[model samples]
Target: MNYDEALSYINDKSKFGSKLGLASIGKLLEKLGNPQDGLKIIHLAGTNGKGSTSAYLSNCIMEAGYSVGSFTSPFLERFNERISLNGRDIPDEDLAKFTVKIRTAANEMIEDGLEHPTTFEIVTALAFLYYNQEDPDYVVLEVGLGGRFDSTNIIRESLCSIITTIDYDHINELGDTLEKIAYQKAGIIKKDGLVISYPQKEEVVKVLKDVSKDMGAELIFSTEDIEVVEKTDYGSKFNYEFNGIQLNNIKTSMIGEYQIYNATLAVTALLVLKEKGLIQIKNEDIYNGIFNTKWKGRLEILKRDPIFLIDGAHNLQGIEKLSGVLKLFKYKKLILGLSILKDKDVDSMLDYLMPLADIVISTEVSIARKLSAEKLADKIKKYDKEIFVEKNIKEAVLKSIELADKDDMIVFGGSLYLIGEVRTIVNLL
Candidate 1:
């Protein structure tokens, strides 16, 4: 099948919807010769910063002269962005080939009385296959959702397990409270594995400590060592002082103060990787990679003239970061296209962003779970009577640009789905 045909066939399995188990994935992988077993992996899971962490770590490893494979979700542009070798995303031909293989295996499973894999499962299998075929030195794997039962958990162990800040997201599946969510993310920690984490709530920290003790994992906390003194659009200036090492003047290309923690977490994980003899990387690689890395749809300034800021801050923790950055920018005519999954805290998102918006353009994303534009508009009207509803995201983009002035800023967010669609519409991808 061609790339588009393969993608269509694979996505159709989403109709069965999130089954939330590894049994099906395990069986399927076994049939495909267990591509996950032959490689070293740096498994990462969290409520946020997983993508940025993975990207930085992969780049660092690559700079050290190792072939690195990275897997991230909800691609900003083409479906191929979900898998990459070194810095380049998987080529269309490779994705097409892997999809065909996965489809063949899936059909065989169905014929043998097994259930078909879900969209995430198929895509994950393809990542493993692609990485294995490329013979990478390491694979930087980020969990698509909650870590415990996630298909990526199939790896028996990793060189190190990293968890960025945990918060309430996917409440229906991963629980609501911070402590509950922490436990789910902590699932990636294996017996005696090295654990690296960002600053988290006290209760969440306690839960992680308890889990690490139970699993005999060695835990490294960012707050215990790393410190940040400055932040700006250029990069963050920080100091890294470990028991045996002290490094200064570390700067990352990513914007926002929150990335300071994410950068530190990546450094901590790299230190652990070095100790394990996995890859001997230098401090220069860390500095260069972090300073150069950029995760799109997070406080991204798409157009400077009209000032279009697009972010994928869907959950409360993410939105909180967005709110912080928005406060730093000058006031302008804010045109927003916000839509989140059904389980998200829609009310909290509106409560946080409504006050900043001059003209709110609510719209649904490509996904079915997206809250309808009309419904969101109606809800926002209760908070502010002048909410605009545009069902089509592309049309919403045109409207936002048309109504916005040169000095004005158009902020698009509330979901990664919306940010991705906007990227496609604006030809930024």
Candidate 2:
């Protein structure tokens, strides 16, 4: 199959839906010779910051002269962004090749009476197969959903399991309560393995501690060991201590107060990796990696003249962080373009962002699950009376630009799908 055909074939598996268990993936991997086995993995699971944390670690490892594979989800521009090696996306030819092999294995699994693999499961299997073939020194694996039964959890152990801030997300599948969500995220902690985490809520902390104790895993907290010395829109300067060694003035290019915690977690995980003798990396490499790491669609500035910014703040926590960051910018007016998925907490997210906008333009992405622009406008009317409905994302962006002045700021967010569409329309990708 060709690249486009391969993508279509894989996307067609969406008819199988998103199953959360590892059975089908495990069976599929077994058919593919269990490619996940013997891999040194840095498995990460959380509601947010997973991709940023994964980017920081993978870049650091790669800078240390080691081959690193990173697997993430919900690509902003292309499907190839989901699977990358040493900062380069999977080549089109390799993607086609892996799809053909995995498609054959999937067919055999169905022939053996196993259920058809879900799209996420097939993609996970493809990543494992690709990384296995490449034989990278380390693979940074981010969970697609709740970690316990996630297909990526098929790996029995990891070099280090990192759990970023856990919050209410995918509640329909993970659970409704914070403790339940924390339990699901904590499932990535392997028996007797080292686990690193960002500071979590009180309930989340209890759940993580309990799970770590039960699993016999050593738990380390980044919040307790890392301190932010200074922060700005450009980045942050921080200090971290590990094993009685104090490292000062650690810097990162990822801007946001919360990103300080994510960067610190990445650094801490890498330090643990170094101590375990799994990899040798100097402090200079760590510093360079942090400074060089970039994760798109999170408070990204697309244009400076009209001050256009786009962020993928689809959840409550994400929206809260975005709102906080917006406070630091000086603008004459806030022109907002927003869209969200049906399953998100739209009311709360709207409540958080609507008050900050002078004029709101509601829009929907091309995805089937996206909330209609009209319905979203209705939801926003409660918070802000000045709401405009544009069903097309591109039109919504154009409308936003028309309403904004040079000193005003135009911010587009609510869903990654929405931001992706606008990014493509604006040629920011």
Best by lDDT: 2
Error of 2 at 210 (Å): 1.9
Write one digit per residue (lDDT tens) for candidate 1, span 1-429: 898898898778453466667888998899899999978989999999998888889878877788889999879877888899988889988889988988888988899998888888898999999988888989999998888898899899898889988888887788878888898899999998988888788999998999999999999876556677777655578888765767788887777878777877888888777877777999888888878888888778777767788888988889889887776666457766677777688898878888777788888876668788878887888766456778898888988888888888888898887888798788642
Q: State the local distance difference test value for candidate 2.
A: 0.88
Any runs in candidate 1 off by more than 4 Å, and if so which? 13-16, 224-227
CA deviation > 4 Å runs, candidate 2: 13-16, 225-227
Counted clashes in each candidate structure:
0, 0
Against the hidden reference, what TM-scores do the models get? 0.95, 0.96
Q: Write the per-residue lDDT of candidate 2 for residues 91-133, one digit (tens) a residue.
A: 9999999899899998998899877788888889889989988
- Error in Å for residue 364 of model 1: 1.5
